[model samples]
Structures are given as C-alpha cells and as structure tokens.
Target: MFSKACEYGIRAMIYIGQQSADFGRRVGLKDIAAEIDSPEAFTAKVLQGLVRQQLVTSVKGPTGGFELTPEQLRTVTLKQIVVAIDGPDILQGCALGLPQCSAKQPCPMHFQFLPIRDQLNELLRTHTIGELAGKVHDGLAFLKR
Candidate 1:
C-alpha cells in the first residue's frame, strides 16, 4: 500500500529510532541502509526528505550521522512520516486509485473502503516511531526478512 520509498523511509526511521533510543548512538547512512536492507542512494534520498520535513535530524562531521531527538522519537507518528515522504494524499486517496472518488460521487468501493481507510489513518496517526522501534528493539517485530 506504500511506495517503495515510503516503505524504506519507515524502516529507516524505525532503525534510526531504535539505535538512538536503545544504543544511545546516531546511525550513519550506510548502517541505516544495511539495517533496513535498502540501497544507500535511495535511503539517502528518503532521509533527505525526512530531514527536510524536520522529522529526522542530520549531522555532519567525523562522528556525525542521523538521529531523532528523544522528543521526536516519542512524538513522531507514522502519519507524519507517511505524509512527509508520500504526502497526505496517501491517507485520504481512493483505495482504487480513482482521482475523483469521494462521498458525493463515490467510486464503487468508496463506501466500503471508508471504514478501512479511517482505521488505517487512525493507526498511522496514533502509532509512533518509538512504539515500532521498541518492538524491534525487543525483538517482538522484525524490520528485515
């Protein structure tokens, strides 16, 4: 349901958050890409978007890399990341990809998909990167195959 970049962005965020929260360290691009099993170039681009959105911080120097502040780890929701990389439309766009789908001029599946979309939006809005990172940190969830 998410673009490849968005998928990688979410994974990168979780990994970065995990490292920052659990290990007290920032993660370099190479490490973030390796942990998430994504290409460095693509992950760098995705990270650029997150940095642009102020969802993640990027530092430059000998020991510089990427990290989320404790406040960001706790407060940055999946919805924010999704919207940052994929735009807010992903949460509200038609499931069938119809450009004009809506309540008044509903697509065939619009009414049926409304509740599901709402539930997804709620999940994204409430679920934080910290929560998912914690799951990974505790081995309750896996980011890689």
Candidate 2:
C-alpha cells in the first residue's frame, strides 16, 4: 500500500541504521542512494521530508550530507518512518474511504479489516527501527533478480 518513495524512505532508514552503526558519522546522500538502489532525485526528496520531521540530520559541508542522530534512531519507529514519507491518513482509516466507517456504521469490509488494521498498527507502534532491522536481519532481504 506504500508508494515507491515510502518504500525507498524505509530502505534509506534501514540503510542509515546499518551504516551509522558501522561508520559512526554523517553519511553522504550519494552513498545512501547507492546503498538503497534508488534514484538520487527521488531519494533526495524523501530524505528532505525525513529531515523536516527530524527523523534524520543533514549537513552541507565537505564531510556532510545526511545521517541519523542517536535520538532519531532510538526514538523513531517504522510507522513514523512510513508516515514521514507516506503520511498516516491511509493507515488510520478505511481503505474504501468511507466517511462513516465506525463500529456502529461499519463499512462493508470493516469486520474483515478492523482486526487486521489494528494488528498492523500495533506492530508499527511497538517495533522500533532497531527491532525492525533485527527482524529483517540487516541485508538478508532476498529480492528476486
């Protein structure tokens, strides 16, 4: 349900988590884009949004571009990362866009979706970036060629 920008944004964060953990400095945008295998222009825009939300730090000098702060890494969650790029509205409401989606005025798929949405939301709420990385196990994602 997420956009390419949102997917890249998440990949960028996970990239930062692993890189910052290893390199211990502000990472360059070029490196981040390369690591995540995304286009520079698009990733730049996504990274800008993350910067505005304080989910990442940016620098302009010779040794600077972007990096995750300690607090950002520890405090940010998967939902926050997704929201920073994709927004929270979709994840918070009925996919069908019903105005009166509620327990009393339930949407057609409310019964089927309510529990699923709740679980997904809960997973996002509880899972921190580090925890998510641990589960994904850092570079173990097997994408088909």
Candidate 3:
C-alpha cells in the first residue's frame, strides 16, 4: 500500500502541476506544504526527490520553488505517482504485498485485477503532463486525494 508519505507527495505534485501550468510561476515548498497540509521538512524532501527524477524543476531564490517541466506536467494513469519517488515495482508488485503476485502465479486479486493494472500502466505511459493541465482546468481534477 502507498504510505501517508506517498499520499502527501502525490498531493503536493498534483498541486504543483496545476499551479505552475495555470499560473506560470514556480511554486514554493512552503506554500505547497501549507496548501497540502504536510509538514514543511517532509514536503521539502519529497519535492527534492521529484526534482531529482526530472518530474519537477526547482530553483533556489526568493521567487523560486518547483514547477513541472513542460515534459513532466500532464503525466499519469498510475494509482501512484512516479516510480522514482516510489519505485517501478509498484507496477509489478501486489498492492497487498503478496509474494507470488504475477501474471504467472497471481495473488488473490489477480483474477480480477491484471487487466485493470495493465490499463493503468498504459495510461501512465501514454499521457503527457500538458494533457493533465487541460483536464484539471476543465473539471479541477488534479486535486489532492
């Protein structure tokens, strides 16, 4: 299962994705943390990981923080965020942490789950960051979950 850290990290990213794209300004961590209701230090570290993964761009200054690069903005269909912060294994592993979960052996839910998982992966692979901004604007969908 995704941790609270994972949830907050995703929420932070979604806010940044919407903000930087709509407002054309890099978002500061303090502001993001406050908006998303996360601890400042913890959010800072998560933001750093996002930067390192090239999912976000960060600058150091009075008017700086993070914004998604044009390349990373609208991306996703995964139940979680990027594999860099979480791990690529989220795609292949069981959400319940089953040891034998796979197409070959399958965990308990596999009979009902593999197709949905594959669809989610395809969605993540096909979408671009810019695509998300439009969706977010249309319905305010990129909201914190």
Candidate 4:
C-alpha cells in the first residue's frame, strides 16, 4: 500500500496528465485537490515533491499553475511517482513494519509478501501516467466522484 502522500501524488499526476492530454489546460493546486478529493495543503506539499523531482511543472500568478509535458506523460511511471514521494520503502520494506526483515533473517510474512511486492513493482513500472490519463479521457477511469 502507498502512503497518503504517494496516493495524492499519483492522483495529482493522472489528473494533471488528463488536463494536458485532453484539454490542454494547466491546473492549480485547488483544482487538483478538488478533483482528487484531497486537502489543498497536503496536495500542494505532495506536488512540491513532484516539482522537485521534475515530474510536474509549476508556475506562479494568475493563469499559471502546473502541467506536464507530453514526453513526461509518456514516460513518468507510477513507480517514479512512488519513489519520488515515498522512496523505495514501499517496494522493499517489511510488510509487518519490521525494520530489519530480510532474506537471511526473514520475518513470518516475508516470503509470503515478496512475490506480491514484486508483482506490484512490475505493474507500477510498466504503467505510465499517459495510460491512466487516457482512461480518464475515455471515461473508463476516474479520480473522484
């Protein structure tokens, strides 16, 4: 599972991508938070990380906000967003919150959780934001009600 920040980051990215790919519009933190049903302050903080990672672009003043380039939309995977917000902990951390769990000193759930983690990593790596945005554009997926 992802942290609240990571969840907001993914939703923000997909929503921003949809705006770019479907409407050619830039998005503000308020708009994004509203669309994703996230708090504005928290969304802004999450987006700050994406901006720092160069995953999303931001600007100031009226008519200036955030947007992603076509190249970014096509290449920025959910894994990248996760790493940007949560680091590699989600993929490598112990399922039961054991800090020292590893193959040599395995926890009870370690073996059981490894394959599921691997599959999740693969799915996140392979799926780009563009694909998710395309789903939104086609009315196949949504970020909020």
Model 1 lDDT per residue over 70-127, tens place: 9999999999999998998879999788999989999999999999989999999999
Candidate 3 achieves a global lDDT of: 0.72
Best by lDDT: 1
Better by lDDT, candidate 4 or 3? 4
Better of 2 and 4 by TM-score: 4
TM-score of each: 0.97, 0.87, 0.77, 0.95
Each prediction's whole-model lDDT (CA): 0.94, 0.78, 0.72, 0.93
- Give me candidate 3's TM-score against the actual structure: 0.77
lDDT at 117 for candidate 1? Answer: 89
What is the per-residue lDDT of model 3 for residues 1-145, given as tens digits with 9 covering 90 to 100?
A: 5566777777777778778778888888888998888999999888787677667789888887888765576454234355656777666667667877777887778867777767767876776556665677678574545
**Candidate 3 runs further than 4 Å off:** 74-80, 142-145
Per-residue lDDT tens digits for candidate 4, residues 87-123, read 9988889999899999999999999999999999999
lDDT of 4: 0.93
Clashes (backbone N, CA, C under 3 Å), per candidate, total 0, 0, 5, 0
Q: After TM-score superposition, what is the CA distance of residue 65 in candidate 1 from its true location, in Å?
A: 0.5
Q: Name model 1 segments beyond 4 Å from true.
A: none
Which sequence of candidate numbers ranks them by lDDT, best first?
1, 4, 2, 3
**Worst lDDT window (10 residues) for model 4?**
56-65
Report the Cα lDDT for residue 112, model 2: 92
Give the winner by TM-score: 1
